[model samples]
Target chain A: MNFPTKVYINEVVLRDGLQLEKKLINVEEKEHLFKRLKSAGVQSFEFGSFVHPVRVPQMANSGELYSKIQQAAGDADLIALVPNLKGAERAAQLSVKNINYVFSVSETHNLQNVQKTTLESLEELHEISDLCIENKISLDVSLATSFGCPFEGEIPTDRIVSIVHQVTELNINTLTLADTTGMANPKRVFQLISLVRSEFPKQKLGLHFHNTRDMGLSNILAGMNAGVSHFDTALGGLGGCPFAPGATGNVCTEDVVHMLHSMDIQTNVDLKELLKASHLLEEIVGHQTPSYLLKAGPYDKKYPVPVST
Target chain B: MNFPTKVYINEVVLRDGLQLEKKLINVEEKEHLFKRLKSAGVQSFEFGSFVHPVRVPQMANSGELYSKIQQAAGDADLIALVPNLKGAERAAQLSVKNINYVFSVSETHNLQNVQKTTLESLEELHEISDLCIENKISLDVSLATSFGCPFEGEIPTDRIVSIVHQVTELNINTLTLADTTGMANPKRVFQLISLVRSEFPKQKLGLHFHNTRDMGLSNILAGMNAGVSHFDTALGGLGGCPFAPGATGNVCTEDVVHMLHSMDIQTNVDLKELLKASHLLEEIVGHQTPSYLLKAGPYDKKYPVPVST
Candidate 1:
């Protein structure tokens, strides 16, 4: 039942959450949301991704959005997702301070997501790593499908360990293990995180989870128990699994903050302000997000007592 | 990260899940659902309540439904909820083998719900205890708002401890601490359950949680860590807090079973068959439920790989 006194949240709504969205949000709107989150005490963000416009039109304005919000970010860490060397080049050109290079450990997902084999993606990660160093940008590597693969199922722990070993060899700021399709359980997360921590004691680690099977928060708890504090979450739970059409998205930022704060595990984020951002996100997305806090409110919220019969 | 190897589920969908629904399902439909759940290896059920028909019109046919399904239930535990002496009399006249007596720990909620104060409810519990023993029926007591109340806010730990001490003095078969408004966090759940366990070492205890803040599964995990094994869940995540509209309901049965099985903690319930029952429940309720497994499937389900581009 032991837990960390505090945890770090890296907001990913602008990148991972909005990537699969149908309506492409303009740069102004993205900046507006960014400023709102900044006011809500979000110190780190995966603001956007530098992928091709044709492939993911929703994130086509990454550079424009960054330019608009960078000044307002103050001391906040603004990170961009870079899928390959070209994405790295785009991020470097935009003077993005941090970049997260992501690849799937599962072969089929790697091919489907990036049109490259696992080996090819690792090669690209090397190039992306070198590019980030040359451009004076902090680099973070995320091993997607580290938990399990939607198409392949049950990824071997050895595969993730080997990938982590290879990725840690580079000059990276953090290594994140992602449950790309929300296939991880608490036991798997605890075991994998414990193994990786023991193997790479000096390496900084992060976790990204999805609530697709309603195990997202539980997995995060397990990861925290395993000594990993950094986590990726989306505002209002505004992301969806492209492969699993009706499934839910990432671990919700507001919901996670609410739960953490309730448990006395500080995230330094204001739940009320974060919920306001989540409400605004619902408007931006033109739909209700899968946020428990948004619907149920916080645990301490008091309702007026009804008249006695 | 340690968990119970096998946990018992007390299905409460028939009573709790449907009590709030506006549409009234017939006895035949209830029988159908009961048979479906039984086939899925569910051996215990809070099948229906014996409240006044005018108060809970949805459960008006509890006696008829119970009679229809009792023969088919075989050795399965078909328990009925009784909120007062009249309800207990109704259950006794129907020859019900087991009955659950529930009252709110919060005086405001108890007065608002049952037109009685907490002390008056305890007085009635003594009477009901006598009634159950005379009728040769097992009795279980559920203390609602054990975590926090929507109107009263945080219920004192001392209050709950005192209530548990009083209730365990009766001839109750089991005692359940219910998070009536879904306000229990993992830390609170762990501390409260641990305290209760130490106070009543020989008492058979259970937990009932709501997913209002998305901490239902995590709280269950914490409760398990504190040595409690029995839980109450609803199919398809049915049920809601009458005090908090639009909030999610109880911890979903199939989702809980899925996570437990994934963690190698057995529930002895077939997840796939349980899903089939959930689907039937969705059709019966005429709306999509808040079930994660219903939307995302299980972690082990392998989707066919799309044709390579």
Candidate 2:
């Protein structure tokens, strides 16, 4: 039950969160969110993605968003999602220092999602890796549906490990195993994480989980127990699962930080400030967000007794 | 990271779920729910609570509900909540085979919730234990706020241990540690469960948790890792934190069963049948319930693609 003293949280609200949103946030609002999240003590931020604008219109302002927050992103890691070589080229042109190229490990999910087979995506990733290296950008490979697929049920652990082997052999040091549809359980997460750590002892690992089945925090705890501390979380739990209809988004950043701090584990993020950011985002988005911390406050917060006015 | 081969889940939806619900389900509806839940393979059911009707109008028909479901409860454990000697006497008069006497561990919470100081509640519990013994009823003690308190945060381990000592001395073999406000983390849960297990090696333990802060399942995992298998869950995640306004209820019965089955941990409850019960409850309640499994379906369920209508 031992947990790491510190865990790294990369706020993905601007990227994954907005990508699935119905309304497209303008560059000004995105910049406001970026600065607010940065002030909340988040050291890592995923600002936008390089995917096609028509495909994900909410993230169409990535280029402008990157430029808007470039000055405020000093010392903090700024990341973007790049789906292929063209997306990587767009990110490199934007002078993005860190990028994650995501592809699904499940064959049917890969083909349905990105219109590419697993092997085809792998080949494209090789070219994308070359482009990243030439542009002097840090690239982390993200495997979507690495745990299980909405289209094709449970993915074998060996398949995930083999994909890790291929990516690591390409000299990519950082890899993220994403629970695309929130299909991961604690035992499965622990087993897969342990296997990945055993096979790639020097690889930097991150876990991205959706809260579709309410297994997000449990999976995070399992990752912590397995000695992996890096996680991707969205502010206000802003993302949605495209394949698993009615499923929720990524784990809420504020809730994750709150739990970690309550457990005496350091997240290096201010929970109070994070919750403020969530509130601000909710206002800008014109709807309520799915953040538990925003709704429930901290554990020690006391409710005011009812008074007759 | 080892999980038990089998876990015990005592569905408390009939009692805890309806107690806080605004719409009071009639006895016939409750009987139908009870039959459905039992058919779902739930071996233990907390059917009703013998509390004042003014305090909780929903559970006023504990006697009649028990009588209606008595014929269907064969070979399965039928449990009821008894807050004091009077409640225990009522339960005994109804010929209830199993009963739980609940009291808070925190002094302030005990007084505010039950109008009794911690010592006073313990005194009442002793009398209730005597009544149970005289009637040959199996008594389990439920300690609310065992982990944290809304009035007094972070209850000392020694205080909980002391309460356990008192209950164990009363010849109560089964005990439930309740996180009334969902203020539990995995490390704290494991530590507390470990301490209780060490002190009372022969004690049968169950954990009751609220999902206020969304740490319900994680705490369950911690308890499971500590070799505490029994749990108390409510259908549709019914039951709110009376103090923490807007906080959700106990962990959803179907979601818990879904995760357990996904993790290869046997709960002996059919997930499909459990979901059917949740749907039935939602129809009766006339609103969307909070069970994640109802919204997202199981991990293996696939969604149809969006079509141009």
lDDT of each: 0.89, 0.87
- lDDT value, candidate 2, whole model: 0.87
Q: Write the per-residue lDDT of candidate 1 for residues B210-240, one digit (tens) a residue.
A: 8988999998988898999999999988886
For candidate 2, what is the DockQ-based docking class?
Answer: medium
Prediction 2 TM-score vs. true = 0.97
Q: List the residue pairs that clash in candidate 2.
A: none
Native contacts kept, each candidate: 0.88, 0.68
Worst 10 residues of 1 chain B by lDDT: B240-249
- Per-candidate DockQ versus the true complex? 0.74, 0.64
User: What digit string (tens of lDDT, one per residue) describes model 2 on residues A164-260?
Assistant: 8888988785699999888999999998999899989999999999988998999999999998999999999889644445456889898899889
Q: List the residue pairs that clash in candidate 1.
A: none
TM-score of chain A of 1: 0.97
Model 2: per-residue Cα lDDT at residue A107: 87
